[model samples]
Target: MTFACGKRLFALIMSPFYFFQSRRRRLKRQKWRKRLRRALFPFLLSLPPTVWGNVNDFALIEGVRIQPPAAAVLSPGTSQPNHPSPIHPLPPLELTAGRVLLQRYGCTTCHQFGKSTPAPTPGPALDAIAHKVSPTWLAAWLEDPFTYLPASRMPRVVLTPTERREIAAFLLGLSPGWRLPSRPDLPPDPYRGSDLFDALRCQQCHRVGGEGGLRGPALDRLGTKTSRRWLYAFLKAPHIAQPGTPSHSFHLVDQDALDLCEFLVRRAPSGAELPDDFTFSEQDTILAHRGLRIAIERGCFQCHAVRSLRGPSLPMPAAASTADSWLDHHRATGETILQFHFLPTARLAMHRALQDTTSIPNPVALPSDFWKLPIPPQGSTPEAYSPENRDLAPEACASCHVRQWEEWRNSRHARSLSPGLLGQLVDEENPGFIQHCLTCHAPLSEQYRTVTDGDFTPDHGITCAGCHVRAHRYFGPAKPDRRLTASRFTGGQHGDAVRTPAFRQSEFCAPCHQSDLAGLAFDGKLLQNTHGEWAASPHSAREETCQSCHMPDGQHFMTGIHDQVTVSRALDLEIDWKLSPETRHLRATVRIHNRGAGHHVPTYVTPAIFVKVALGDERGGVIDGTLQTRIVQRRIQLFENRELFDTRIPAGGAWLFEFASQLPAHAQLLTVVVEVDPDHFYRSFFEQYPSDSVQSASLIQQAHAQILDSPYILFVRTITLE
Candidate 1:
């Protein structure tokens, strides 16, 4: 046959196959389009009418309208302008929503957005991807994370089928020679796993079938997406799979892990299978290389750690740049809106995710003149009274309540404006930032330097007046008799005390202790979750509160982890020792229980407890190398916005530390020391503030030194076994 005829014959033969591929691609696109519309329709409908006005003037993508730069995005409590101007319009909802979306998705991790330093990327490190998940699951996850986990913060990057397979190959190929452990022959008991789950209090952080906490991913259909083998491995040691995962290591036995895997896997719908069309070959170096390039080009490295590629840090957004400018820049480059085919869906998803995760309420509005105390009520202020009585000061209150003042003086509330905080504020030019810190540190309006009130005492830090006096009237918890009245003599001095039950409620303290900043959260948990922690505990149901223990007997001492006695009372330690005389070996098992604390023991990330076991000589010291230590704390890398691990014992939970070692000669004693560092995280944070880097260097140095001295031995027990 002629060459031309051969070419024609080949083309005819491949036409049907090409047509089938084209049809499949078109159907896939249609499916996603419908899904996006379904997800976004209700969100768009709920927006204010103003947002939909002049829809023809805005960009239309897949039947949804994107608001123009002139359109205003009104949050709750925001009102529309009475008379809108054509030349200078209100800032678009797009800009506001866009900035929020950027932060929520961790865009600032690689790209500069504003004056604030970029937070660490919140993505889990992928070093052990091979062991954590099957290649099929990884490909499906990379293709569209929302399919498997709707609440995931990861944005779907548009990629072809080949690209998806390549990316999966690249990630799975990270540890080329890695292999999964052999599965046990015996079947696991799901019933036992269910009991173990409850015992571990997994519901405290994770959800199942839409009925648990939002701190971790929902496990409703986990079995369908992952294999029992992978689940068992993950349950055994979550950190080994994903180093920065917020999931705690429960140190489960092999049988327990197997049973938990069985229980979780049983949750999948009966006939469901792992989602993927093609198998990925980790040995395909060419495909992996291509995938790495695609990952880098698509900015996957920005949020995720791609071992083969290192993304460069972009320049910070200009100091003068506003949110509007930032959005405009991204829009101009088509990076934020046009690059992603489902931008509308992503935006709507972001709104939903935030609503689900954010636990804190909106900021309460204060009176316009809230900074100044109201004019002393009609006849309450007497000219016969001295300045001490009229002035809004802790010392004035101390004149009558001497004992409470003495306790408050030595409390953390008194030292709220610690050198560490003050040092950082010294160089902070933003008034909003300063106010945010002082909101909890020195809560009184008069304590603000800008208040211009004569009673401004910034150094007093959470004075008695801050909590008890407002609008020149005294307020406190209702007396046991429920009487709102004060004595006839004292009533004239500070006005009739306004007795309210709110003063005794946990919600009263939530404002400062619980935070909901989307940018600061890890695994959907707030940075400071003490109030949230208490709310989830049995204490909240029983009406026990932060004040119950911290301020026992209405004492002003606000005792916390810093108080050695308080900490010792919260934790119960038990140690078991086994010595092998023939082998000259010692094995120690120590367990620490959070029995008293209403919240997690060492609740916040600031404190860490070290459980150490070491072999000691007759002199009580000279053993060379037989020490083992386990830390109990929430370890987080703040700058990277990643949580390495959370070993903090939850209320009523316990942690086990096992140590085994061959004893050296002359090791006559075994010592176990449990040390508590109240300022563990702060020590590292403050150490970064060098003299040349900040204006308050001396203060920072002093703060570091103080933290170094804050650690104290919580428990020490020596077992002599010569």
Candidate 2:
């Protein structure tokens, strides 16, 4: 070049050429990367779970040591049984790196917003998780990602145990579902609690407005008693709120529960000032110690965790050996035993453990007959009958009241007394005989000191005081505006008396009617299936409860199948007939339906009803010796797993019977009858196990008389067959 000047100019030109070569190289590299992605994208998108032999198993390749199956080498995001999986899973090496690059470079955002076309569902969308899973389950799953539903697609995230619980609580809030009633919108309304409490029978355990039972803490002041948030949580999940408390899934509707919360909150006294009568036990050492002793004797500490009372700790049941891990795992020891009993396999494990040691605590209370209620120590009445409600004689109320007294006396609620029931009270030979007979029958026998053993407060039968008095307080279903004060004669007793609608609800009778005993269920059918029947009945859907029918027009007669009038009013029977001359046969078809009753026709194991048909001659001589009997009852054979045939006509269901007989020339009469024997079987049951003393023989005679005289023959028809 000139040479230096020409060389400089050429150099400048060459610099641009070099820059262009470098740019071309970069473009070529990017194109190759894109081509690689196009090839790998489809394969990775398939989420192929390539199963292969252990990666550690080496293979000899031609002149090269082929590494452990490279595909099996998990990516950073891949899940391992021992380790938590990452936020989102991806394949290993180039595939994962390429996808991350594509995401980082904003290549896949065109269609799916971020990541890939088929994007992951955002965590917020899982608000519907409440409809899908239980709150406890969700919490447990989130606590340790693998704990519940290990196959769940939810990736392991950084959250503490408390955070998981809080998230679960929020998620568990009821949301609108396909079915509206099940997932009702809960608008806060405190007023609804007053009626809802009674309707739901919350007072059966919980005392509210000083008119309910003392089984649960008094709820006269919900606002000052506990925080609103805690109350809501407790109502939603009672067991979770206070662990080891005897809580149940009431299956309350969301709207109803919120309404109840509203009422209970408003129940609090104004300005948080306790009532003038409110007494403090902390100042009185004797009262405080008495309460402590009572709690211990009642076994309150068995389930509840009490932090106070630093007395010597009770010894815990020693743990069983885990040599049989399966047995140990499934035994369902301690608190979970009640739940375990419902599960078939767990029951077997628990039963085996029970042979050695009782692992399951029997917490059942309802139908207390199953628990073999303990008899009070010999010749001891807890108190000489209290004067006002002495013996709770049902007639005693007349001494005080003018209106309800006479109504109650005339009602079946008053006429339920009998001598045979009194005999069983003292009879100690068979504890089962002293079951819930007097609890509902003569519910106040303890107050009257009227029974023998008095184990189960076995009085002759029910009286007024039982339902009215609790903790020396009188309660009843008085109207909202009604004012109640101390009983005049029984001073200090029932002072500032309270009334609640729960007194008239079905829950009042649930003690004797609804059996919580697991033993009572045979093949998932209750022996005494009345409550179950009503629960499944359409009447429940219509809001027709037990009290609605039993106490119609404010009458407490409780007239059922035993009452002919009640029976006659409940059924609409129809009969169709056909006579065949060639076959010389007479056939009558009868259809019986539970058109009116809220439950089965006869809703107890004790009653055995029969629909019978017979053929007779006009001269009263048997023409065709045919007697067809259809038993309509559900009975469980005691101490046996087997059950007697249940032929009960379910509510709103029908029972059809066809009677066929050869019509003889002399056969001029056909008779069809539906016979009911209510107390016959029950009397016979008691007669089999009579008491030792004077009461036994009299009770036996009563039993015999019941079978003979108590037979109710309904719909007796005599027709002359042509």
Candidate 3:
């Protein structure tokens, strides 16, 4: 028994060694067979008549003998035959070639078809896109690529139709069959549907849900709220109808109209919805004082009339609504009716109405005791207030120009009459001068002619009839129909009724702006001659209108030459610095030159210029600093917004300065910064409208330095600092 057990143990111990030996022998035999086959196969294939081949044509080296090809080898199609089938299939070759083409074209640079590695995504991925796109789509896309994406960065690939088909087949094979979500296919006829919607008077304030007016919900995303069939049946027409009320009204239409119902369906998450009925309120009403001011300040009258307090009453509402269509229709038709009638007070009244309803809170408050404030009355109301009969008070016609009224509510002009800027210029010690400047600056209607200590209001700035007066004879841009007509009213406020295109003419502005500099009774004394200065300029001599450069496209978005865009282009301040031991100072020399503008070097459009200097430690904390400036146009009134000044910088001009500061004791690095004013000196302050002519003048300008081996060594940087 002991001998048998020992035998079993011995066998178990040798089994592993035998297994390893067997594997090694098998590997060795495979390697030998491979080598032997390579060596003998060619010789065996060529063994047709090697022994008898011509001995003179063969050569012998050492113990190996060789024979010429003609004597030893078999010819093609003779002994060894060619195979009938190809070694590899064609599909794999085509796929490999297509992939190579994709790489060569750089398609993978921005797009990742199905990459395993993560990379920054430059555009949307096309993973499994084959399931979504049809084969025909791929062909058409390759043919005319631009039709798919107007802003495509993809360059056109010159692939043959066959290659495109192969690629398309490969992509389509990714998913055996993919189906579109179950939704009824709808025709794309949005324009026709829009016309039908309008014809049906559906837009009479009712929105479809999401595709409709802002006043109501546009119904395009209605699937979450209602079912498709319900919508379809509703369109077919509901039996019960409500009058005046929206739900009671019939919303159903014919089969063709029901086609739009498909667009109403959509996918949604749990409990998704639009604003409920409880959210609608007067707050939604937009009272744009900007629009109103454009009408009044630009002189909407002379060619147009409204329901006036004086003269013939024209058609206009007592108050204005914020509805877009209402304003549009009024503007479109108002001019036609104004030519034959006069409406003056309507504009003023409308202005009052807008002030009460607008939501954008006014920062400046109107005085509660306006009647008690010391106010100066006008010499005479413009003739628009004069009635054919003398017994009635002259009615201000501004009461009817609702659009202009709303705009004035938000304008700085509305606050002009407040006892603020111009009023402060009035020497409280001398009330006579206050009354004197009041005539042109804050002219009241003939009906409200009186000077007192208790009747002040915001009606002091440039008012109606100031621009609409007869001499200006203003007309807005010509309508599509170019027929000209004369106003029917007799001459009074709006100058003599005349058939002229004065609105389009520049001379209309000369009256107020070009007023005689020396004798003008404005600002309690002659104010600086701005209009006179402009008139004397070459720009005026060349017949350039103020609106040409100041108001591009006649927009009120006032901008100035010193704005960031203009400044960046005009002045490039290349700053250089060096540390001088003798002076113990870090000196910075700024080389500023105007590059692409036509104005002066430093024209004064606004009042101030500031230069700031700072000495800082390498850690970026300031050690010492100070600022300097020249206030060119100082405020004449105490109440001016942000210290009013009129400063302008000429085009194509440069202003340069040098700053020096002591270096910190342990400074390792230094930084320099030169930035322009944040207010855009000229733009944000003075003009009612300014253009974006300056761009480089951002609020912050900075530069940095690193300490090298030597403290004095430096690198000069040339960039737009401010």
Candidate 4:
């Protein structure tokens, strides 16, 4: 054979391998694109996309049609996989791949999925979801996405009970025949179930043997507490149990769900055999009925009927009354029955209902935190209560520790009750979190834990009474310290002062400063790790503590990052500025050393230290292009469940920021400023709260005051070149 003929034969043999290689590369690229979109969502949050024309075509968004940027090129038809979830229904084989690809891409804000329109929400297309899953399952999934799956991509959307039921009713009405699933008839075995749960690593989120995380609730009594029908259906597909959970769905065998459901049912705790006897007063009965009437008129009847309206929502217009009414109904999963912050119009109507003399509630008021003792979020934490005047409350301590008390009175520690702080709540409704704040601030206010809106937080803060008082005794730094005082109200009381290990160590601040946010993990690291940082710092080896620098002489003013003086004292800054006129280059080498701080300079996520080097005029006006900024923060981008970046100076360490900028030949003034935005992160979220909200508005003003009062400005330097 000729040489050309032999070459042709070789080409033919390798053609098949080349075809498969190209296909694999395309799939790999597609997978990376999906992961990148999710990871950088937060960066794009503030930069929502503008209209763009599709590649030589147009797409529909909502009702208006938009032409994507001409440069945009969409995937060529359904040849692309939609990050295929193994169990989700497959697209119709008859439909062209192009048609399916359009449906796959929903939002072009970052990643465009569909060719024509925007999705109403995240997750699978649900317009015909009724045909795929039962309406009951749909409702359950929408209510609590987590109960069903641990790694679901759905974002939790807060909805009223009525809205959830309305949407569910609408969906269930669509298709009736395709609901529910086919599972095993085998009876549930808790023993086998327990083994499966362990194998599946369910303990990562839930606690069973008292060794799991706090992200999910304890499930030892889950079976006894819930309906078996819901459990079976939920196990099959978590979406049927809860809709917007962050948990991931699994491709489990049908029998897996059946066995798990049965085990859960069998493991449930026994119920109280009988309902406890109770009676209602004429006043209480009338109040409940009035509240029920209001809710019904407000369209709450769709989901709750005449029963419980106790949900984990904002307060109603007359939240004190409506929130306490109705106890007979079962709240659906993921349904917020207690969140009562009604809309403005609803508040107006509720007010009118109350004003009417003839209007009185007919529903029974449920037992709630409004009139019940609170369960401490971290179990029982009892503090000392002193009836005698010997107690060193801030006011009483002012007598002997006059200077320290006065300093604390004007410090950030004295002003902990701001709307920004009050608004720091769990994304999921957690009653325990409500009391968590008071655990450190008020420490002993029962009203703080019980009353949501009506009670006033005592202005004690981390007061003199915080550390010294425990039950009926007082704690101090030394031995043989005791005091007794005669009480005007109840004869006399006794208080013995004993040394406490916490007084001399970091543990004193641990209860409040330490936090484990499993949900706020960034690359498998907790976002809030102040206590941990301190424990690992060089300061720990020498037995130095948070109190060492902040309380040099037992000063009550906890000189924190919020105080400019305190901040200046914590770190040292040295800047080297230069002007290379020949090359038109302006250079700076800023060294920030953690001089006194025991941990990261700022210590927390809230404060951000900003270092800016730029060309400026004699009047302090900045020239463009010569500016470079470095931010030192904890990178608590919890919204994305990931950290973008973090650069902070650790104890006995230094951060060197090198900046070189091309300068205009005539530019002679150079300025280097290092300041701190104490409430940088706080302000980011605080802006989301409306000023018209009485509570938030007050807090907004107070936070402004705190930011103003916080420590800032390491130094300002201006260097002039001839």
Candidate 5:
């Protein structure tokens, strides 16, 4: 064979091998690109759409974008589709179904919601019901609201036929002299009204025939519930017809309002008739008086506003009923329109209401026999000593423990039965209610008037005997020195003290400072959860207890949210600012850290911490529209029985409040103020009890004034700028 022929054969075989190697390399490059694209896909999507102009035109796979021609390009400053602003993210406002129920049922009248004051009473004022609706409609509604409007928040109220008639008569008789004016000009136009309803988007907030938003009441039975004239008046000017109504006036022409009213009223189910004209008569006077009695008995005034009826004065006939009985009645009979039986916590709240007791549960766990007075020491006569000595009053204890008594005297515990509490209990005739309050406020048996026959003085609030004295023996924490024994103490007249290590544990304080009832919790958090909060914190692992901080060094002064020094110590605040010369704007950031405390800075719902920032002129006055405020606290809607927001900083957690605004031409300084309100909830609660509405008006007024005086500035800082 020739040399040239052999060379040509080898070259052909090598050419095929080289082609396979090139193909493998190309395939490897494609795999790498695919992996890289996958890694960048999420990061690209997270970027603003403007980052990749006309994002919709491109199909993004992994990190690569494949776009077709004709895709629009978005340039800087060009208008874009409306999207949520991303400058700063805010916590979402949480509203629960439970809260809606509470508001609908008029529970907010007595209970508050969030940091704001309690909202106006939910139920309509009954003073003008006679002039507003037909007597037949009123009776039917009072008897069974669900039958008329299936989505009604008004509870069934368990009224009998006679009771319903009487209640209707009483309400109708409220405005006996006034009558609804006839409006003959407005005529029926159901078809036009239906069109107007759709144009107005009425279903956005209201429901008709069980389809629409739940913001407003269902209009399914409006025809049977209200007259044509009344409905037209309401549609024309909702605010004027029913002040504070959530319904808004559409500024419609008279004819349009008439049409809309007709359309809404026509939504009634088949066979339903329109409400007829109503006239009040002298015979209603007798029925009204009886109705008033039943209304008071049934706690109707608790939620509904009636000008003729004052706050409930008569004691509840079932005041002696136990919590279980109250719960059972609500569960079995369905007296509550909301059907509280399904919610154990709600049922418990109803029980508390029936008992006229505060929603706060007993804090401390006491023995069954804890309230019983101890038997006098052997041979000690019942009348041998003064009442103070016999009862082991605080004054007697102060004689021996001067420092501790002095500290405690200035503490909140000493004023547990302050004017606020006393005012509520002053007109309260239910002994059970009073007793439940005294269980924590004035725990000693001797302090209870019912038990001691007025022997106890109200001034001696939480007496020393309440915590230390039991069975005529002194009880307290064990001595720090393990070597010391009870035998070492000399028994003079008072006898040797009984010591236990349990007093040093946090559990000892759990009874009063913690609520163990799951039903009482909102958002899975107890109303008073200091102990639980501490348990979840790192301090608990380090063996820190409530006494370690609140009662440091065995001090009787239990300093808490009210003490400026203590609160300041628990929190760490920092303020930083940066001035942008380009935009002539100043950005300031204020950070608050719950650094020292084992739990939340303000551990209970009662206290609120506010951080306020604003621009100030040379005179130190805040500039208009330049102020910003942030609150750090657990905000609850008492009536709604739900937590609206919990901005409270947990242990070791930090909350940031950022402010960015253009520097005003005359701005000279930046000021920040931090204020603490120890009685925020109490202030709102006290303000709700109007002088004319409640029996203990004077006391409530005094309480309101006292609570108003409780807020104090915690921190203030000012920075100067040229």
Candidate 6:
């Protein structure tokens, strides 16, 4: 702990770098020359004992190998009342006495059975203690350890049997699962952690599992050595002046902290090797320090911070000093530094240097964005659409938006030509329909051959890469390069190569949804008009694009209660419900409070949402028939000559519907189910007749009818409907 010792320690830390460099420089003078034997021996001996174990497997890691339990100093059974004596008792048993003694002496500092790890190598691991020592010896050791073991390191204590027993029972009952009594809850989505990682660009220096730059530790599994709370605190605020310095205090937000902790804990080695607090040799420490310096010298900290700057600005370098002031300010205060940045070349150089220093990885030049494998430009007129020329899609997007892809897998856009509503129109019944569908549905480049017969590829329908990647430009379906449109086509590649830019913007989704295909016709007119509807709305006039409303806050999954709230606010009707009691039966009423739905609650479509009441007991035993009633029951006609069964109440008009059902006399609860059908549709007039020529009329009708019969339910409240 002296300044000299600190400097020596720091020197030891820097030795690994110097050792390798010294050896290399000496090698240039003499072929395969070894170091001066004595000098090299001390340097080698200077290594941390743990590193020696790492290299030779001979040196033992201190405090790791199990030692004999603290010698049996106290008589058995007297430690606590409930802890029966393993041997004859010499004193009275009590738990409170042990508790008092422990609290009075601050024994909890190093021996936390729960969430804290006070100091490394402070004492023995006490995760499960009944298996480690006898209750009698534990009590005696707590009271006066020097009594039995002359060289006992533990201090003597004075406490009654009650106080001693209390502490003893607490310690003896310790289990690995012990944690603080109160712990905060975590959010469902750990997306914040992923965002933090990207914001910090941790991969720039730390190589995790052979990937990423190796300027820092290969934290393939870090959770094994650290706690989640510690990591979370460290990510945001690094311990600059503390003993650990900048290594262990990178503070993280709650979610990111938890998620990263989960990720690391999952990476812990399968089998335990060394004890948690085992000390390392001086050599290992030196190597680590040298490695850290190398990382810094190569500017690995530019993008990846072992200690990130969370405040305002990037960390500034140490200021130049005058000639006479080298030792003037030994205690000079360092300015708070924010962050660092590295150029592509510098990053690559550091990567190479670290690999050479560690003998871990051979540097290989990779594309700037490794997620999307780069392709070279080829000489061609119309951009060739070969698999080789196309850019591989970036996987980084998936890292942030995994749940969105899962939902899109079965969407209409994903399966535009696979026997769904759109695909039915492209079957052999109409051979030319495939070409027409592909214009908007598949959105492929013109270089690909046109469809002449029934055909499909994994890339046939709207896929992630197809929509996101395009030639020359990104976002929206721009016209293909004109060079390929010539009559005598030269199948050469052009500058227009598939590039991913749409993933960053809303305009990317507009081309297919907004414009009409060249050939398709619906009843001698245009077909689907989602884009048209969106554009014509007031939102479009106000510069609100399709994604703004549908995908609130740029989330991958573009559907939620917010959309319902937005649309519901625009319309006048607000559907609210409650239950009424009547004898043993209960009446559930749905009251529509019209606020602002431009049309009606169930307008332009037929949706069946009703109030259903059911009586059940604690064991979920049904006792009565379910009573069901619908607001727009049995398709009643209203205004505008529309199939008014699904009527639109005036902007401010209200409607009330009710259902009554008997409850079990012994029932404590009755369930009232109220739902909203987001995907409801009225049978079009054409669909009501057999003459309608829409290709999937029957299938569409079947899907529509099933939905009408059983719509998606919404809120379910179990009031004392009994």
Q: Write the residue-wise lDDT of candidate 6 on 309-332 in tens digits.
A: 122221111122321132132225
* Candidate 1 residue runs with Cα over 4 Å from true position: 1-386, 450-459, 485-492, 517-519, 690-695
TM-score of every candidate relative to the true structure: 0.46, 0.42, 0.34, 0.43, 0.46, 0.34
For model 3, what is the alpha-carbon lDDT of residue 357?
20
lDDT of 2 by residue, 146-239 (tens): 4333333343444654444444443344242322223245577766677878788888878765577877877775554444554665677665
Better of 1 and 4 by lDDT: 1
Per residue, candidate 5 scores C-alpha lDDT tens digits across 1-722 of 11111112222222322233244465564454345434444443454333333212343242245542442232112344323222221111111222222323333333332233322343577776765677778876776766776546566676887787777777767862344445558566989989888888889987876699988877777767677776777776676566667557458777787778778777768976434434457865767776765775554654576654432222332264653553454245332222233355444433343333211111123332332222112223222122333556677665435567778888888888776777655644334335445656676545655333534454567768777766554456665442123122111123233455556777666545554332145667656667778888988889988888888888988988998898888888899998887877999999998888988878888889989999999999999999999998898865455799999989889989999999988898999899999998787566653222253677678778877767899889999975
The 10 consecutive residues of candidate 3 with the worst lDDT sum are 699-708
Clashes of 3: 79
Clashes of each: 2, 9, 79, 69, 8, 47
Model 4, position 167, has a per-residue lDDT of 48
Residue 263 in candidate 3, Cα distance off native in Å: 4.4
Whole-model lDDT values for every prediction: 0.60, 0.47, 0.34, 0.48, 0.59, 0.36
Indicate the residue-level lDDT of 29 in model 6.
Answer: 24
- Of candidate 4, the 10-residue stretch with the lowest lDDT total is 484-493
Query: What ordering of candidates by lDDT runs from best to worst?
Result: 1, 5, 4, 2, 6, 3
For candidate 6, the 10 contiguous residues with the lowest summed lDDT are: 357-366
Q: TM-score for model 1?
A: 0.46
RMSD of 6: 33.9
Model 1 residue 188 lDDT score: 89
RMSD in Å for model 3: 45.2
